[model samples]
Target: MNPFDNILDDEEIQELRKNHNHLRIKFNVLSIFTIIFIFSGMVLFKREKFPTYLEDLLNQPPNRLLHNINQSNRSNYSNVENFQNSLVSNLNGGKGTIQLHSQNDYWRESPLFDALKSGIISIETDCWYLDGQDYELFIGHYKYQLTNYKTLNSLYLGNLNKILDDVNSYNYKNSIEGEEKKGVFNDDPTQTLYLTIDIKNNPELTFKTLQQNLEIFQLKNYLTYYNTTSNEWFKGPITIIISGENIPYDSIKNLTIRNTFIDSPLYEILDISNQSNHSEFELKYSNQLSIFASSSLEKLIDYRSSSLSNYDFVKYGLNDEQIQKLKQYISKAHELGLKVRIWDTSINYDSLYNSLKTNIGINNKGNNNNNIIWNQLKELEVDLLNVDNNVDLLNNDAMIAAIGVSNNNNNNNIKYHDIEDNYNDINSNNSLS
Candidate 1:
């Protein structure tokens, strides 16, 4: 159609072509300069480690990072759910080494199974002993949440027995010299699975029901036991620890051999005035009969201030006041061969919501900010993080870095879970039990 020819004369067209060529040359020069600048920067920083930047990129907050990832890949999150189901299936079949605080919360469609698949070693189950209808014991955080199908036998013990059987079968087929029969966990054969039975109903009745149910696994030697005469402990595949109200030492004092251990009151035990009834028991069996000495984390750490920094005497870390208290509490427990576990530490919103929605109110005694609290606990070297988020705690980059593990779940060494020791002379005179 020659529309440009009709609009412009030959002299004007020549001028247009020259102008276009000049612009093209200028653009090419700018592009070449930009490339040179980038190359120079690489050469200048060649001595520096590039992997450090990559690590920094990966170590973002789990919630924020997961949010951004989900926002960007809406379809990918859907795929992740599908992948999670497959992951659970695979874990049920195979072995994994992840530490978990499966503390009576639902993570996936399957709570306990998902927790085990992810290598959660610690599981907390709240038990309520029913009075009628053949004396059934139920498992739930509240009366409303309890269901006939969700009994401790149905949800926890039955599944646990299956896991033990599977692990034993795997070990028999693939036995290694010097390697004893491992627990459900494949990575660490000596890892002891902690089944914390927190009683919510009549403590004596609930515990009695629990002990009766435990007899199912007792024949298989799947529970830890203490011999009073020999002062020897046979750590089994599963260690049953009891917590909650009415944990009177007088209840189980007469037994020559005990399978279950008690959760000691770290705070109350320090005060001699509160030792009216427990004085003899505390002196005699506090060291041997208890594995974890727990108190409220809020009581330990001051979280009133907005700023979590400032290593002042009143705020964070081992301030003078805290140092005295912790030494009185933690040091005594450690001296008595017990590890410290602080409960009621703040958990994330997702977990909190899940708890509240299910009529299971969180302790909610600590600060809303959990990251700072977690950091402080790690710095204090407190054992057994009483958290609700199984996935976040295990996957959090800051948590992994702070704990000095690339993956916190990979280390399944749980011989450190229970303290192995003989009662020292500190309580030698009070061995009346």
Candidate 2:
């Protein structure tokens, strides 16, 4: 050790120590600056809005988020009530001129709740019954989309039963003389929620299974039912309408009392009433048998054979002839005391793009072709406007103005124009063929 110590001078050793300390200080300063820069960069990035993906993830509706939470915890009834409360709070107390019908609510719980939050009164679910499935009815637009959890009871019937139970119990507990049974909407208690079930397979078998699934609601008397004994319809919080091709009318017809009703074909109402050679099921169609008369817009207007497609209705708007035809079908339904719902009114992305490209110089804020067709439908006095994207339409203020209704209207009653006078005025100029 002494031999090594003698190899270098004391001054040289002190100089080496000073240089090492200086290097250590510089490294420490660099590290502090590096950390500060990274933190500052993170702060700046966060100050701006989240990236699109993150934003979307965070912006999911509370009900949907709760649904996921509920999936993991099956026994959480409070989550369902939370979902219901969130939906009820977002409802516009009164309905607009035309009630909105959700086209694909069967996809999931989110869409159904989304439509309800957007003030939609009519909800549709596509149900299929297979020979060997555990559930009586599975809900989906296609067979491949079905899941064990998406049964008729799980997605719709059971949820509705719970909602009605909670709503009625709360109303009865708080009000004097047990307030007349209320509906899902706290703002509009008398408003009846229309639940349209589109049977996709085995109409007879599927409908029978659906009846079994509805026993709970039937027992609770929460469904609007026709009593053959009294020859009258007793209004309730919910109305069940069966729709789809080859609907087994015989199953529901001739019942002493039934909570389920049919969705009569809108285009053939006049034919069924006037023709003698029609089927017995067709002949029995009446206000007592059905609540809603529905058909595709193309079918009602006889536009299937035309060069133009159903999407063209959004682009070119309805001609005078088409308008007259729609009016006739709508008037016929009204005369029979049935509400009319026109579907297949969605615009494809290509059509929307083309429309925007063509209307470059015009004021097209809310005057898109879709809005034009919506206005036309409302003017035609169609009761329920079947919409594919109700959330987008209801959220757009300018579109709401174009449709001529304030979503903020808190009136207890929905104001609908008298169809007779409105129909007469439109037909005064040209006769309905």
Candidate 3:
């Protein structure tokens, strides 16, 4: 259509057309490539360009898997579930704190009454509305205890809001936090409190009431409910409880339930076994399990005690062959998604400084394998490590030889299940020098 079009020769016109066609093809290809590059850049680089909260998700414990007293999935039972459209934890992992018990064993057929008696601030129970008028929430009997209230009744069964109000109204208490001293003269408040509820059927409406109560109470955060063969009170809180310790689940984030024999595995075994014997013991608490104990190297040092020698780990527990096994244990722990802490059993008996006294080192002679341990700790981002040298931690005899921290839970404190067991359980609560 241009003025030059008619005047141009056929050869020039054809050549121009050919050049335009080639340019057109090149332009199309370049456009496609540019679009793809933009898209790929967004997915590959720009996606992570924003400050993603990867640590907040990764560092926290799982909620559905096994939530403790402080954590409950807000999304799953949210007053505002849809507000946070994210993954599991990010969606529902924030609750303030629910003051409840976590005794590992013994619960009633109807755990509801346990909640009422302040025997347990929170509990898990099965609801069976077998009766036409009511559904019984079974506690210790393994059979539904009939109740007159409907499932929707706030008194018998209700939302978390009411459950919490009830807990506060009842003046339920958390007994243990810090215990610097233990004896017949001292007292232990973190004992298992038990109460029985007989809900005679009428469960349909009553179960609703119970659920309402749970939600009202926000027992999800402070209380843990578990099913049991009978309705009885059991030990609550799997983690350590110290006297005067006010550590709430809301404040403390990094928590762990260590297994027995890692260092003091025998103690755990004994405690669990003893709990099983009691008819009132309830085993349905949180499902998280892993053992935190002294390393084999520390265990060997414990055995040698005053007679420990250099390279004892190689001779007793840490040879090249065994060292590989240690790495395997570490790897397995990681696979299980457990946060591991190194138990410095040897620190309780001797000092790391003493071990390095005679070691041959670098040109400076002061640097050696001990430094390697420190480097490993820094490199591994260890949660805890210990030194036996009391002086190394700045306190000689005043502090418990723990991971150089003043956490109250580190102090030994004993708790009892019944008032009568008070005297017998005192010594078990004593802290070691």
Candidate that scores best on TM-score: 2
Candidate 2: stretches off by over 4 Å = 1-87, 90-98, 170-180, 278-284, 307-312, 346-370, 410-433
* lDDT agreement with native, every candidate: 0.56, 0.64, 0.30
Against the true structure, what is every candidate's RMSD?
20.4, 12.8, 24.7
Candidate 1: C-alpha lDDT: 0.56
Candidate 1: regions farther than 4 A off: 1-100, 105-109, 133-135, 170-181, 273-285, 301-320, 347-372, 396-399, 402-433
Clashes of each: 2, 0, 97
TM-score of each: 0.60, 0.68, 0.24
Q: Roughly what TM-score does model 2 have, to 2 decimal places?
A: 0.68
- For 52-170, candidate 3 gives per-residue lDDT tens digits of 22222234433422232232332244422221222222221231111222221123222233222222222223334353433233332234343333232322333223323222222
> Candidate 2 lDDT, tens digit per residue, 1-433?
5778788799999999999999999999999999999998875564233221211223554345223343334334453364344324334434432367888775423545565555567899898998886346988888898867667776667656655654454322333421235666755666678999898989888887888777666666677777766565556678898998857888888677768888988988877777676565343456667878899887887776655454365456787888888899888887766778888753453453344335422243544333566668877778886766566656665555444444665533343333331323322321111
Candidate 1 least-lDDT 10 residues: 47-56
Preferred candidate (TM-score higher): 2 or 3? 2
Clash pairs, candidate 1, are 98-119, 100-120
